[model samples]
Target: MTIMSSTSLSSGLDSVTNKSYLLHFLQLLSTCMAFFLVTRESTWSVDISNWSMFVWCFCFAVTLLTLIAELCGLQDKLHFSWDRFLITSACYCALFCLSAAIIYPIIHLQIFPDGSPRHHVIAATAFSCIASVAYAVEVVWTCARTGEPSCSLLGLLKRLEIFVACVIFAFLSNTYPSERQPALVWCVAVYCICFILGAVAMLRHRCDCDESLPYSCLGFGQSVLAVLLYTTALVLWPLYQFNGDFGGQPQRSNELSCIDELTSYLCVWDQRLVVAILTAVNLLIYVADLVILTVVSDRGSTQGLRIPSSY
Candidate 1:
């Protein structure tokens, strides 16, 4: 048997803890910066801006709470109970779907116009696609790890809600710009109601569990649907552009005007740069999660090892 000195063990733990904290801090910083840039530079409609703000804010809150929990050594307390985790994850999954819907048109229309030499439009589009995949993976991972039926059920409901929202948005995009706002607002309101209903149901049936197999299948279905919808939107985006059906007219001139006046701050930035940074940060977080999961699984397996009684 090999032994580690107490000091060496403690030092190793400290190194791991510090690395975790650094990653969290970087996530918080990148998210905040991206939010700031989007708020200032996004030339999309007010509805899209509002939705983007909501996503950035949600990310900010999660990261902040996680950082505080880590520093305070209160991670266990901060862990979402299985039910809460399902509900929260469902909500985020829905939000990501909505994001993909909104971003698709924006990228195709060049709403934020990639003036940067780095081809920000392609980067932004790539990030949006990757982010959607990340969200889907998160939903499925949560369900699989918890073996919770409600998790998959709630995810299904949210995915359907997002699918309907995207369809409506696609239809509206073909309509006159002046007429789309009210319809979009109403659609958002209805989805919000549905989301709330799902949450309440989750709360009411916290202890409920059906066989995991059906829900696992449903979870897989939901993920596939999400990827399909997002990719479909991406493919349809260029068609919308070519047909001149992306809103009433291009707002590129107005966006350029806004950028010119922001010589002090946002002028130097473009959506792609912000998006690339956010994507990197999200990838880091995903990698960190995988590492943590591996460590936990290894420790559990080690603890389970036992000599045969016959020996």
Candidate 2:
């Protein structure tokens, strides 16, 4: 009986390990290919290619490290939950690859000279897309297979909020025209603050230290704060960027003057619009998170107060 039980357990472990290994291996392979293809082109004048290379290299390194750590059982020695960390990392990697896949082609392909090798860009974009899909699948599979309460919908939301903030940061990094404007600075602060809070929440949960914290209260409070801050940003950003009275462009300029290298990647006007939209999207997400938390907490409290009949 003991021999049979050990054999069954070993088979289960092997099945689980095999799936994870295959997924991470695929992610590493695709990211490596994408990175190599882009670097081989040796085109750095565009500037945006740097971001592409960074994304591919980052994903490849992280995936390789994760696979190694898991295979060697190093995760058991970590202070935090390895599964949670993996899920969060995979989610961000997926988004990063997806953005790279989209942006790399848009910025480089159109600008490629007729005699230049555009196929490299095309192949790199394809590999990035594959890496993105693989990472996304890994996240979903891990969450579903583990079925950990911490990897629930709330966890997904937290990771998503962080990802959106990252995208906003990337767009803002292209240029900081709002540097002198206090309102825009405050908007950026809002993004930073909310992102930090979400990251903290994830950290606390993954580290198993949140049990002592008033989790529900803290989550609700943070959600409210995020909603308010994002609402302010959602209104202020568009006003300051699109209003003609503020010396802002009311429409995307079609003038060739807007066709410079910087604008070719993403114009200031378009970046502002994209940031505003993302802010609104995050605001809605926070509001949904708030509502869901409230409902869930209420249910929990009600269940706790329920009287059990004599059994």
Candidate 3:
């Protein structure tokens, strides 16, 4: 496996698929938990009638862009060619934004009342979707072509991809299929399913690679933390989903004598606060990720030159 030429330097980048997949899964899970918690606290109305559709649309568009990048493979070196990277990245970004425009209305984000400040919803939803798609594409593309062979562990990436798929499916199951109780149930199902899938995928890969554990990590550890945060969000979001299930039940609300057991559970545990805390923590983690990526880039200069670390 020894490298004989500079031509093989691109193998280290694991491409855009798995890394982007993990980041998006975590990002969405955070927002979902945040919205769930705020609504429970009676502090904010987390509107998603318009927001959810854009998320859905962006997911599809990114799926296509990542797949394409994965197939073509991009330049991966300590210093990438900015001109080519910018052009390709912009092309990929356009797809995500354009597709979301058509998809938002299909999922009932348009259900918001007329002339009641849909602009924020529109702008936020569109911006979030675009950034999400861009991040996934960029990271994945970077990984696939980089010289760091250790980052290409199939075991790691597969788990992340499965996690993202679970989130997408969980959201879809709520609308297209039958209505299920405890919106939290869907969130829980996604978390458990993704956790299981990732665990199995990692185990299946049987990676023998090793890296030192310290106060800092290279790229792979960052991906692991991202998945873990996503799992935490999934567990936390159930609190709010259950609230939605109970609140939406008009027939049960009318009949006080035969109160639903689930409603009793929601009343006892305020779902809003739980979701808000989870969302806040997840956002904090998201910020941490940006910091981690920046730090790694800063260290890139010392990479092949074998400069000693203060750590």
The alpha-carbon deviation from the true structure for residue 180 of candidate 2, after best TM-score superposition, in angstroms, is 2.6
Error of 1 at 250 (Å): 22
Q: Choose the strongest candidate by lDDT.
A: 2
TM-score of each: 0.42, 0.87, 0.29
Q: What is the C-alpha lDDT of each candidate?
A: 0.42, 0.75, 0.40
Q: TM-score order of candidates, best first?
A: 2, 1, 3
Reference-based TM-score, model 2:
0.87
Segments of candidate 3 deviating more than 4 angstroms: 1-108, 113-116, 148-161, 172-194, 200-311
- Where is the poorest 10-residue window by lDDT in model 3? 207-216
Q: List the residue pairs that clash in candidate 1.
A: none
**What digit string (tens of lDDT, one per residue) describes model 3 on residues 177-272?**
124544545545544554564444333323211122112343445545555656555554543333445443233344442254423322213233
C-alpha positional error of residue 101 in candidate 2 after TM-score superposition, expressed in Å: 1.6
